[model samples]
Target: MQWIENGDLSFLDNRGMNGFLEYEKAVREIIAKVRVNGDKALLSYTKQFDHVDLETLHADSEHIATAYRDLPGTFIEVIKEAAGNIRSFHEKQKPDSWDVTHADGSRLGQRVTPLDAVGVYVPGGTAAYPSSVLMGAIPALVAGVKRIVLVSPPQKNGEISDGVLAAANEIGIKEIYQVGGAQAIAALAYGTETIKPVDKIVGPGNIYVTAAKKEVFGTVAIDSLAGPSEIVILADDSANPDWLAADLLSQAEHDPLSMAILVTTSKSLGKAVESHIQKQVRSLPRAEIAKKSLDDFGKIILVEDYDDGIKTVNKLAPEHLEIVVTNPEQILPEVRHAGAIFIGAYSSEPVGDYFAGPNHIIPTNRTARYSSPLSVESFVKRSSIIQYSFEAMQNNGRKIAEFARYEGLEAHARAIEKRIQE
Candidate 1:
């Protein structure tokens, strides 16, 4: 970690990975091939990219049953518990269709409707996140999406992860496909003989998968063009240096591009945390990856006070923000931007990543300043409900016509005027 005593927050800017556009041409070709050849292309891509020849593109109930039998009892129980927590949290985000009648005798409201179907692209290979399965699927289920499909790359033995299958089974996700990458995205956007098209796609993936989602965006809605994992910790002298080091390393080990930053008022604390990071990282299995991440993107800025620290954080708008101070509540309201806020030392970022009720899928690369974490709202669409009664139309139709005519939309004006009393 590079410690800057002067606190230059200008280095706070992160890399913008716009749905991994660098892979656009290749992703487009993959989509086109899937469109033309369907299941054949999926099989070919799976063999070519995943390095596995799949006999079938489906993970059946037998496969799920095997997953349960193979896994330990403790892991299975944990998955079940985590799924319950996720489901409970998202269920609260469900929006009811509301109606209101005004004095004009006109009904104006909003109707929330869940998408017909959704596809969750779970990344395989180096990143097999069963937690992402719960994070993505449970919200869709809460939104009342009728059909939820799971697509992930099969491993060397032509099977998805036992943990992944277990998570899906816990949530009652029926459609599980042994497909992934740009090809899986193509299969989801455009229907195949075995896998039907979906209304939206969610979950994180590599450059190719993200690029494929970008290309097929209008064809099907996507959660977001999420970038790499990241975290920012704002702490005072009250925070434990050892705990701080562990928290920063947690995100650093995720990817080479992942960032970990700390802003503090105590210069001595910064030095201590930096030392702890070095000591802790040596023992990590992904030490090389974490070392590279910390070497490149890790930072420690010593500010004069929390005000300057928070100002810098607002500009950064990190995916995860941890505020560890004497009184965390006093500092929280100043946080204008962040995907998720972890208040106090005890509130580690990883809690939300797995067992916690909040969704772990967050906006990265400063997007949290504008966007939000995935929720039940992402799975449902809202329609404006407008019903103008005869009396109401007579009273206000002229105003509506005038508003349209102001924009020089003659047809729009005439349409409203057609029902006017005058």
Candidate 2:
């Protein structure tokens, strides 16, 4: 891992920080093709990327039922438990439609409505993340979205993961497709012959998936253009070096591009953590990927004081911020930007990612400064409600007309005038 002093080096300025660009262009081309050609384009891309020859892209009820039966009882129980927690957390975030009536008998308020349909994309290359299905689908479910469509790449044998299917079934998601990558995003954004387009798309994916979401954002809503997983640990000398090293490695093992950094005021602590990482990473199966991530994007910045360490963390705006300092709450106020904050030594990033109930689909690559974690709000829309009584319109008609005329909208002013005359 790279070592630097807080005042001398700015960690966020590193050139290796940006998301991979080469894969983005490929995804854009795929999106355009799918948008124009629809199902034909989807079939071609599915064959080329997923290497699955499919008679039909959609997963039928029978397929889903079989998946449910195939999954072990213990895993199914775990999914249900996790889904309950996720649903409970998001249920609190549900917004209500409300109206207020004035003395003049005019009513005005906001109407909260669930999105008609939503498409969730789950990555299928390395492994099946049943937890992701629960995390992504529960929010839409809690918000009362009518239709939930799931899209994931098929395995080499042209089958969807049993766990993915089980989770979808548990959440009452009926429409699922054996599709993945940029093409899956395109199919969801623009309907194919078999698959219907959705109002929004949510979940994490590779660069191709991220770029496809970015391209189709205007046409369809998206959760976020999430990048690789990342974590930043804000620690002091009091933190356990072994725990600190393990936390950093957890994120590092996510992807080759995933970043993990430790910002501390203790040089001795930094050295100890580095030593611990060297010992800990060797036994892991993903050591090569973790090693590359740590070698390139990872760093340990030794600061003169705690304030300096906090300042650097804010600038980096990592996806996951873990405060393992003496008093985690003391530095909590200093953290201005972060997707999620894991306070104290016990609160690890994985806890939030899996069982802690908060959405783990966080903003990455410095996007935490602007974007936020996925929630019930992402699955609903707010429409302004306006009802004006004749008396109320008559009272305010002149002001309304004047405002419309000031904007050079004669028709708008006349419309209000005509209503007032009535």
Candidate 3:
């Protein structure tokens, strides 16, 4: 980890996205083939890319049942607990339809409605993310989405991850397909023979999947263009240097591009954290990846005071933020950006990633400035509700027509004028 003082911090901006342009041609072709060939393209791509031949595309009850039989009871219990937490948090976020009536008898409001269907892409092949299944599916279910579909790549045994299946089963999601990558994304956007099309798609994947999501965004709503994971810790002399080092490594181990940084008022604490990270990186299982991430993106930034630290962290607007100062309450309100905020020493980034009720699928690459963490809101759509009484239209009709004509939209003017009482 490198140490720097609070001067020109523009070097840490991280403006560029992952190598997206490199994959655009490939992704466009994959989407085109899936749209034209449907199930044939999905099956052929599965066999070609995943190197596994599957007899069927859909996962039946037997698949989930086998997962329960094989998985450890303790792991199942933990998954249930995590799922409950995620569900409870999102349920609080559920939106209700509301309307307000004006004095002129005009009713205007928003009618909140869930999408007809949603697709959750869980990455499979090298790793099984049971956690992702819970994060991505539970919110849509809480939002009242009627259909929830799960897609993941099959492994060498021609089966999806048991852990993933177990998570899906926990969430009451039965519609799952054994397919992944850009082709699977296409299938989710446009229906195949085996899989029904979803109105929206949510979850994270490799660069190819990310590229596919970018391509299919207009065809179907997507969660966000997620970038590499990142974290910014605003700490002081109060924060334990050892714990801070371990926390930084949490994001670092995720990928070679993942960024971890410490913004602190105390120079001594920054140095200590940097030293601890060097020592900790050697012992981790993903040492090679963590080492590369730390070498490239990790930093220990020194600030003049608490105000200075907060200002710098706000500009970064990292995906995950932790405030471990002597008085976190004082700093919490000042934070204008960050996908998720962990307030104290106990509230580590991983705690939110796993057990905590908050969704771990947060905006990365400084997107938190405008975007937000994946939540119940991500699964629902809002339709503007308008009901103008004759009296209301009589009052505003001519003005609206005049305004429409100003924009040179005569048809729009006539539509309103037709409703107005002479």
Candidate 4:
């Protein structure tokens, strides 16, 4: 990991813009083929990439039921617990349809409506992420989405992971398809013979999946162009190097492209954490990936002071920001950008990722600057409601017509005029 001192913001370029641009042409071509050819394109891509032959693209009810029976009781219990926490957190985020009336007998408010159907893409390759199932599906369920469809690649035996299916079953998601990659995204965006199109798609996936989501965005609503998982540790001298190293390694294990950064005012603390990382990473199962991630994308920046470190963290805008300082609460108010902020050493990133009430599907590659963690709001839409009585229309309709005419929209003005005249 590179160590930087002084104020240089260029190190904040974690997501290489050039790398994404290089793959854009290929991803766009895949999206275009999927859109034009539909199911044919999906089958071809699935066979070529996933090495799985499929006569039917959708998973049958029997397969889903079998998954439930196959999964262990302990795992099912854990899923239930996680689901409960996720549900509780998102329930609070659910916006209410509210209306307010003025004395002029005019009613104006907002109506919150859930999307008709939503598709969630779960990645299935090296790992089966049941946490993702809970994170993505619970929000849609809480938003009152009627149809929740899930799509994931099947193994050589033509079966989804038992844990994934169990999570889906727990959430009451019956419609699941045995598909993956950019092709699955395309199928979700444009309905196929077997798979139906959806109002929105959410979940994290590989670079190709992210690129495909970006390409098919206008055709169907998507959560965000999720990049690699990342975590930034803002530690002080008071932080334990062992705990800091463990937290950083936790995120790095997610992907070889994932980033783990440490910003500290104390040079000794930085070096101590670096040594600790070397020792701790040796025992991890995904140590190879974590090592590569740290070698390539990770950093240990030595800021001049705590304020400079905080400023650097804001500019980086990491997906998961951890404040392993003496007083985490004191510094939390200053953090302007971060998908989720973990305060103190006890509140590790994994806690938020799995058991915590907050959603873990966070914005990556500095997207936390503008984007937010997935919530119930992502599954619902709000429509502005307006009702005007005769008295109210007579009083304000002329002003409305004049404003519309000011914008050179004569038809809009005339429409309002006709309503008032009646």
TM-score of 4: 0.95
> CA lDDT of each candidate?
0.90, 0.88, 0.91, 0.88
Per-structure clash totals for the candidates: 0, 0, 0, 0
Stretches of candidate 2 above 4 Å error?
8-21, 60-63
Which candidate do you rate higher for TM-score, 1 or 4? 1
lDDT accuracy of residue 61 in candidate 4: 79
Alpha-carbon shift of residue 65 in model 1 (angstroms): 0.8
Per-prediction TM-score: 0.96, 0.94, 0.95, 0.95
Q: Candidate 1 residues 1-422, lDDT tens each? A: 78777656665443876436567888999999999999999999999998999889999789898887788999989998999999899888888999999998999999999999999988886556899899999999899999999999988777898889988888898899999999999999999999999999999987788788888999999988888788999999999999999999999999888999988999899999999999999999999999999999999988889899888789889999999999989889999999999998889999989998999989988999889999999999999999989999999888888999999999999998888865
In candidate 1, how many Å is residue 92 off? 1.5
Candidate 4 on 39-133: residue-level lDDT in tens?
Answer: 88888888888887778887877877888888888888888898999899899998999999999999999999999999999999657888888
Scored by lDDT, model 3 comes in at 0.91
RMSD of each: 1.5, 2.1, 1.7, 1.8
lDDT-based ranking? 3, 1, 2, 4
Order of candidates by TM-score, top first?
Answer: 1, 3, 4, 2
**Per-residue lDDT of 230 in model 3:** 92
Better of 1 and 4 by lDDT: 1
Candidate 4 lDDT for residue 33: 88
lDDT of 3 by residue, 1-422 (tens): 77777456776555446479999999999999999999989989999999987778988679789997789999999999999999899889988989999999999999998889999999998788999999999999899888999999998888899999999988898999999999999999998888889999999988899999999999899999887889999999999999999999999998898888989988889888988988998999999999998898888888888888888989899999999989899999999999999999999899999888999899988889999999999988899999989899999999999999999999999999999877
